[model samples]
Target: MDPLLLQVLAAKQIPSIGDDAMLLQESMVELINSNPKAGWKAALPSRFSNYTIGQFKYMLGMKKIPKDASLSFPVGSHVANSNLPAQFDARTAWPQCSSIGRILDQGHCGSCWAFGAVECLTDRFCIQLDVTISLSVNDILSCCGSSCGDGCKGGWLINAWQYFVQNGVVTEECDPYFDPVGCRHPGCTEVWQTPQCVQKCKSENQVWSDQKHFGVSAFNIQSDPQSIMAEIYTNGPVEAGFAIYQDFPLYESGVYKHVSGKLIGHHAVKLIGWGTTEEGEDYWLAANSWNSGWGDNGFFKIKRGTNECEFEENVVAGMPSPKNLNSALSGGRE
Candidate 1:
């Protein structure tokens, strides 16, 4: 065991044998459970234990850019209120939209950037238009080209939203996700190639252009807690990009805060709602693309209000075009 590794584990209160503190060695799980201050539960998830910290970090693929002046949206009075609930979950709020609760895996790619955007957009279509449709994440990942970023390797959220307005994306039923079961099993590495862009639909009956859905506008929200709550409360869910630390993958339950481990990488997830714990810690309920096997059944509660991991700073979303929806409902393509 390296002396520095021991020091880090002690400082983080995670019992370890001089390895990456975030790596789920068997000893760390017992140490994690005994340490009350650690706040979250740790498990040697057999799926996660298969890879080293470096390999696991490669699984994250959200590449963020500076906030554009033209892209920010004002927190409208539609959702503004002083009496916001202490806890709110989008799944509970919009039970009619099954997509709100559905979790998808990004697989062996760093396509979380695309997953976060489409997941939120899929929920928003149901929430805003009273129309239930699962948007295709693959459409953005494979086809958006250099404008969206290098597909699979990573992507830009704003560019994705813009692509929705400019080029549009097909339904999940048309294209579907590329690698649904790739990254979950043991021995998986950074081998997910950027899927080739295909303009055609998978189904014989669905025309690629007719299956396309569009966004009205792309924009960012105010980073304040109330503003974020108002956005999710009014608009369903929003995509949030944040700095991920090593202790993140070990998160099983409780309001997560950076406890131990090095800065791994930046990743994105969908912020579905907000809440406070029984212990009175405030948190944002988020859905990850790492599949349900990881953390609280594919969801996580992270420290809110304080902008832990800068989660609040990079929130972005857009509205589904009602014209496109109306056209689709009327059996026409706009």
Candidate 2:
């Protein structure tokens, strides 16, 4: 084994595996050795270099999805004008860049659905209201009812957005991640938990009168590149779910596709924009909740329109309400 690869294994505390680990190692080595001309580059050795395929899948967060497949098509309010840019990047799109500098971590919990929804919700609300209230992921995870799945045990993005629009989500100051008590607290390295959902506000004090910030509407986008782009370009950052493959974790930069590694599970992410690479490969720029240490400084670009990893299959977006009081959103024309 390469010394650096061995070092990464030790650093990540990769568990010893039987034949399965060996097989995964060989597959990774083969991909590295072959060096296909794929647009993205995989790591020669990274945190996941020594992990078994099963181990890789375990690290992936997403699982079940909602059975309901209906999406509000023609997305009445978000029809982009002829002036829509062929290429757009929400991260730098002037006032539309509500999600910039706000990358979040789901900790060790499988709360990607919550994180993705709230982060995008926060951005959408901020863009619509010009406010900076950080929405609570914990609230959605704990209070979204039985159908939204168990807290930190994984859930559906559709249910998450639906909950946000209907019930509203409180600020981070209200719920504050995992509360350090739930076994699901990602920072609780020694203890893993299913987490009991309990809503808290300001050290148990009522700094504000309300329990949540809210939006007037939320909807799923058509499973196509054009609709995905129009939704984000018109609304703000949108939430999406994609299948996670073994090769996904090692992504360093550039447009990503399944170059190696087997499929693990699904993952939720925030879709910010779309652009064609200099190589003419179309890609979707998204923000992941795995922290800045993960990929492309906490963000990633994936092959677009190809339904790579089943990404475009389940795109969702929502509209934030005007100011805490009431103001009007221009592009979000309702």
Candidate 3:
């Protein structure tokens, strides 16, 4: 079946929340309930659960209007043009000795785009400057302005990067703000403003063009997503996109096993590591944005190479080609 039609059919099967916030909360509950060994065993109020469910539904494009929905990335934008080759493995593409950090949860806000962009920047920052700084997603989510989305709504990853380049990001604690509230540093105290954020490229004269010139790398993954996952885990967390499974069973205990397709929404996660299931299907260890209570200590593993779980290959297309960045910034081809 066509993926879009299949997604619509699957969305109709899930329960509905009155609004987006409630929808996301519900999804978190389902995610936690799906994983029993993680030890989370508390039930949430219907109101709270509804928020998660709503967000999930809206993200999947099931809702006629989003509770806090905003603009999305341009259509056809992705990191890869194809799926990974069948022979790839996690050990080869990623460096072994890289340093990764703990996973984070964005919680109720469609700030995954910011989280993804910041996670990538943090990794590169660590590699380039030899310092591990957990930069603030709140900063970008709060400050990037209308081109992305409001704090309550969704945003674009490229816009977040532009925000980062124009205004250097600070530690989460330094700015320590949240959505609905935004940046609270009192003027530009903790903010680092680069000319890149709002500056249009001289040649292309596009806001996004300036972002292309920044030092970001993109790759296409096929075969073993575990390897790319490992690279993300070892180097630092990577922003990954996933299709939300609606029928993803509820977390009555904390164990999740796919029963049928009820998945909805397109979510971005931080890849932390990888492990094998009892059935020997490889799963990618991911950090969710649903607070610490969800998943295996705010983490979950998706079966690799099945469904749209292998969408990591598409991430390559979202990356700014090094060659493109150079040419745009240098006024000519490198």
Tell me the whole-model lDDT of each prediction, alpha carbons only: 0.79, 0.67, 0.45
Q: Lowest-lDDT window of 10 residues in candidate 1? A: 14-23
Q: Which numbered prediction scores highest in TM-score against the true structure?
A: 1
List TM-score per model, in order: 0.88, 0.79, 0.54
> Ranking by TM-score, best first?
1, 2, 3
Question: Residue 4 of candidate 2: its Cα lDDT?
Answer: 59
| Residue lDDT tens for model 1, 42-126 | 7766557666666677777878775564345433323567888988999999999999899888887888899999999889989
lDDT of 1: 0.79
Ten contiguous residues minimizing lDDT sum, candidate 3 = 188-197
The order by descending lDDT is 1, 2, 3
lDDT string for model 2 (1-334, tens) is 4535544643344334442553245445445335545567655334333445544443345555544545433242445457668688776774544455567766556788888888988887667667766778878877885667656667777778778767777777666876434223335431234455565464555332264677777676777777777777776788888898656777778898775545567789888888888878988999987667667887889998789989988787777764333211111112
Candidate 3, position 181, lDDT: 31
Backbone clashes for every candidate come to 0, 1, 49
Q: How well is each residue in 85-163 modelled by candidate 3, as lDDT tens digits? A: 4333223333441423445545444566667666666555555444444556665666666755554356644456555
lDDT of 3: 0.45
